[model samples]
Target: MNIKFSGVLVGMVAVFAATSASASPRPDAGHYEWRAGTQAPGPRAPLAVARRVWVPAAIAMTDADVCQSMMTAKSGAMACCASHSS
Candidate 1:
């Protein structure tokens, strides 16, 4: 009985490991290629670069604007400032 239970447990573990490994995304499955001198199709590369730069700047500007607006208002200043303090 103990041997049978151990075998079943080991089988279950093997099945789970196989399924998890197969479910993961393959490294080469995306549009971008990592080989030297092989640029991703035009515009996509630049667009990705721009996004990396612009998104953080835009978020910071938005947070500053919100904080400024909240300070100007008499009520809810504490709550707004507290939330944005982070």
Candidate 2:
């Protein structure tokens, strides 16, 4: 019957989704050779928080930064970055 075939198809899809959801990947060991004389990469800083997006603090932005940031609109330079706004 069409109803029985549809029911079996839905049941198979549900079982497949449940099985796929439980297969999580293993975490990394985070091991490294600190004495190898090469510098290791440090933690990365995120670009955005809560609502505002910004350039990373480790990066040095120039005067052109304000122009680029406001490229989306004709707003004043005061609207560039809330953290640096006076």
Q: What is candidate 1's lDDT per residue for 1-86, written digit by digit as tens?
A: 99999999999999999999889776334343233433457764742322111111222234766657654344434445545452
lDDT tens digits by residue: candidate 2, 49-84: 233333323434557666466634244335555454
Task: Note the residue pairs that clash in candidate 2.
Answer: none
Q: How many residue pairs clash in each candidate?
A: 0, 0
Q: What lDDT is reached at residue 13 by model 2?
A: 99
* Top TM-score model: 1
How high is the CA lDDT of each candidate model? 0.56, 0.54
After superposing candidate 1 on the true structure, give the runs of residues whose Cα lies further than 4 Å from its correct spot. Answer: 29-86
Q: Could you give me the TM-score of model 1 versus the true structure?
A: 0.32
